[model samples]
Target: MGVVADRVVSILLANGVMGMRLWFGQVRWVYRQRRVWVLPAVIVLGAVALSWLVPYLDRRWAEELTRLPTGEFAGTFDASVMATVLSAVASGTIAFSGFVFSVVLLVIQFGTGTLSARMAPRLTQDWVVGAALGTFMATFVYTLLVSLRLGARVEDYQPVLSSLLAIGLALASVALFFTLLTRVINFLRLVKVLESVSRAGARRAAEVHPYPLGSQGDTDVDLGPPDRVVRHAGRAGVLLGFDEEVIAELAARAGCVVVAVPAIGDFVLPGAPLFEIHGGTSLAERRLRRHVVFGIERVVDADPAFALRVMVDIAIKALSPAVNDPTTAVQALDHIGALLLNLSGRELGITHIRDRAGAVRLIHRCSDWTDYLSLGVDEIRYYGRDSIQVIRRLRALYLDLLRSCPSERLAPVRDRIAAVDDDSAAFSTAFDRAVATSPDWQGLGGPAPIDDRQC
Candidate 1:
């Protein structure tokens, strides 16, 4: 009765988990990619069908085993005991196999078929090792329990174990053979034309280069800013992006035309070169040097009035300790309010100081950042969580400048202004410099160029 109850409980629990997963997936149908529900629905239904079949199979196996006569043992193979043992072994084996299959399927589906793709190779390696150890431990425990229950020594069960081993080996051999044959055929099919096609595509993409808008590049005679150029056609690529900000910054620094204005939030797309640096060989060699750093350029869609209110709050904070000039702060706030009145019914885009002497702040609508964010892409390419450090450093720099330096210092003002630039160049440069000594910096975007003409 205990064993029967356990089996029923396991079946019910498994079915319940599966049903919940299906329910969650259905709830997210509007947000997720279309038709993702069909396969999972089929899989859940199949699991439900198998749950019903399990008991029937257990009963049939029990009857078959009971029919066999026992010569040495006094007790017969009772249907309940036999069914319980069989069910335990079958369920354990099936569940383990299902887990393995699901993992392999997910890896193949998401993995680029390379070791680097899917879950990290290091994680997958750990999982395989853990599974092997677990399998050995489980098998040893099961063998010990069965030996104790049947009142048999290990030697007595040697033949049964040998038969099981032989069957396992035969099945493994067949599977290996088929796997090898399939791989060989796939290789042969691809080897015929893959190289030529790959080379041709590469050549074609390299040949396509579209020019830019007027005065986008650095015009400084000594050291110019990057030339702006458009890297891809139509804004379609931002919809599938990993990080549009990185691309946008890269494009701005590269002085490339940004053709496709992404919506509010979106993902980066494949085949979209981050940016097309127009100077070609000259820029390509120093591509790592021409970076434009923009710190967290977050796009929040709220009422213009609310945004103006936030700016007012910031201006008050700026005047508190740093500036200590309530009159100037109040004056700036008044001007901002009056300017905002010009945007009562329509959308407005503006960047200004949050405080009388704080970081440069921009509050605008219809900027490139909003366009990209509207596409639903939130990934940051160059800047990351570490960007907080960059802002803090800039604030510190501002404090220092105020203490000893002149009020009209252009560099400090430029630094503050760059912090709020839609391009985010000044913030990026400072961030890259701060993190250069750390190992984690390797993951961030490259350093900013020495040129400041474009600013």
Candidate 2:
């Protein structure tokens, strides 16, 4: 009986810990994604609270407000006129809000079609869009509430402060509308989209792989065959990320090394092997699973490879026969190259996380330099093989990377250059092959090396 009771207590404790970790993980995801609802929700609630507080304050300080210069201007509107103006503001702003939503949907549709579908989330979660919608909604809510407050009021009982605030909000909404429009226009540009994705990739790469190449010592730790393998029991989804600290702490407590079976961003299914617990007392499977977050789609916040994945998707899509836009492919490579350059200096590959006693507690796979190079170069090279612009740009990219990447990382870059040469050799004519093989940073119209031209 006592043993059963202890088991029940242990299960309850594990569940409680898992619940807290999941909650914190969700909060982090929301923050990283910058969900659109957060700002608007705050703005709408503030409007509701201010709508009540401002009217009361206005009534109390009505006489003193009239003495102020700005308040004198605010007092020009009688109660009926104030109500009319608020009514107009309320109706106009709500209409504006609807229009903004319509425009957002259209923009998202166009962007998803033109850019990679992975970009849809970035478009939808844009803070500018959120700010514009929030401002418009706040204006509508504030004006409507203040207008309701003017009901059955005497002519002298004008909410001067509230009236002024409503007008200010309306004006602010108009300004934000223009700002949002400009942002949308800029976002629609291909270059801007590439730049945005590249920047996001660079940021995530720096975050995930903070140590420079060769900075960390060997991460290998030998633990014999696992005594127990934990299989996932949840619905299938992409492994968004895991909390190394939490997992490491749990492993340390259990006197074990936990080996993660699937890398971040890998699609995991129910019954898939999730962890290999070697040399430790068994851990609660629920506890292990809770520290790892899963989502229907992978996000860049935790997966450094995702950004490269997105760029490669864009590049290959542009290179498709229907599109046959080699220039776009080159542009995509430009950013891909930039991201790789940033990553070239970073330490990558399987990481071994340790606990306070310096014992290896967790093992997880990470994208290595070779994986990134392949992801960034392989597909574009194949699809763009027939396009001279793409060939030349790829040659230049390889040369640039070879010149800049670390000595230890040079083999992959050299191999890519050789691959480009081999692909160029497949051209029908010598002149075509030479130009294709020539490294031109501009993809064309730039001076090629004399030796390259001769070749």
Candidate 3:
């Protein structure tokens, strides 16, 4: 019977050690990978180490006491001394308990299984719950050990100390763990809902024909006055016209590609035109009111870099000799546009134009062009100030290219491709002024002519 009891104790001890090792190993691995959990985990691990060290130090002190003459100083390290020492130790353990609680909470955050496994698309809230449970279990075991140490003391006050420590650690561990896990669950659920709604809205918009602009089947490109008269079948009601070009430019500035084809504000109802394409020559006759194109007229007044970059991108894709990847260029232009907009204190009304404009205007204003129509001609004419720096830099680059290339050495074909001549005279003039006036342009080679061609 004694042998069986001994075997059972050994098994329990081994299990305890294994559990602790597993918990610490998993937690340390998680702490290393999860950027958010690093600070909290370090605090918890440090506390655990201190808790373990405190006991060892206490045992050493007790050994030294044993070596001294027993009765001579029997009460010297008296109840008061023990109380003070124990009180300090208790306080330290309590602080350490708080760290344990925090670790549990954070562990719950990463969820169960390996980090990679937890991140798998198939994994769900269950994994998070499992990790939280594991943390709670670890805390509980530590509390039990603390309780046992206090209970074994012969001093009458020790049991009370153990009970208090156990209760405090258990309650704190549970509270902290749930609070953090609940927060994680709520945040993730909110994100999921938003994602679902967004996907649904996009799908619905795609299914519908693009928002209609006019009675004639032809799409309107004029993005100016939303109330601008759109004539399709020679009959014209003020169908809302979004300047596709302007919106496209804004989209480009926002680092958004594809512009959603029918786009956000397209009126897809019957008798309305389909989505209009930007930079296509197809709309030249019917597309432009004057030399001014019908698509986003508001863009004409926006940051010129955004507008010019948009134009350059479009030109490259449609008509340039070579097409460079436009995504990076588009992002840079958008950042520039955003900076200019911010500096001006103008809302630019882009966020409104993109998403919640309907809530703001409430009626027929679906897009910026419609907003222009609803807001009246006065609002439509307001253009944000241009970034002169970007314009000068662009002009300077164009001029330097021209100066480096000898027109005489060029085949007439390459020269023509460069689009040099009296027509491009502004290129050299702009470059020279930029180099002279702008400190940024100093190191660049002297001003040269540039073709500014698609090539």
Residue 384, candidate 1: Cα error in Å is 14
Off by over 4 Å in 3: 1-138, 151-157, 187-455
Instruction: Write down the TM-score of every candidate.
Output: 0.20, 0.86, 0.21
lDDT of each: 0.31, 0.81, 0.33
**Sorted on lDDT, highest at the top, how do the candidates line up?**
2, 3, 1
Model 3 residue 429 CA deviation (Å) reads 55
For residues 1-455, write the lDDT of model 1, one tens digit per residue.
Answer: 98896575455434433432343233233123223344334433443443334333434554453344565222343333433443465455546545654654554444323211211221222323333323423333333234233333222221222223323433543454355334333323322112222232222111110111111122222223435432333333222111222333433444432223232233334334344333333334233212211111211111122233333333343344543433323332333323222322121122111111211111111332132111111111122223433233223322333344333333433444344243334335775544432211112343333441122
The most accurate candidate by lDDT is 2
Instruction: Please give the TM-score that candidate 2 achieves against the real structure.
Output: 0.86
Which candidate should be chosen as best, given TM-score against the real structure?
A: 2
Candidate 1, residue 319: lDDT:
43
Candidate 1 all-Cα RMSD: 25.7
Model 2: residues with Cα > 4 Å off, grouped in runs: 1-27, 30-35, 66-74, 152-156, 228-234, 282-290, 449-455
| Deviation of model 3 at 423, angstroms | 39
RMSD values for the candidates in order, in angstroms, are 25.7, 8.3, 25.2
Q: Higher-TM-score candidate among 1 and 3?
A: 3
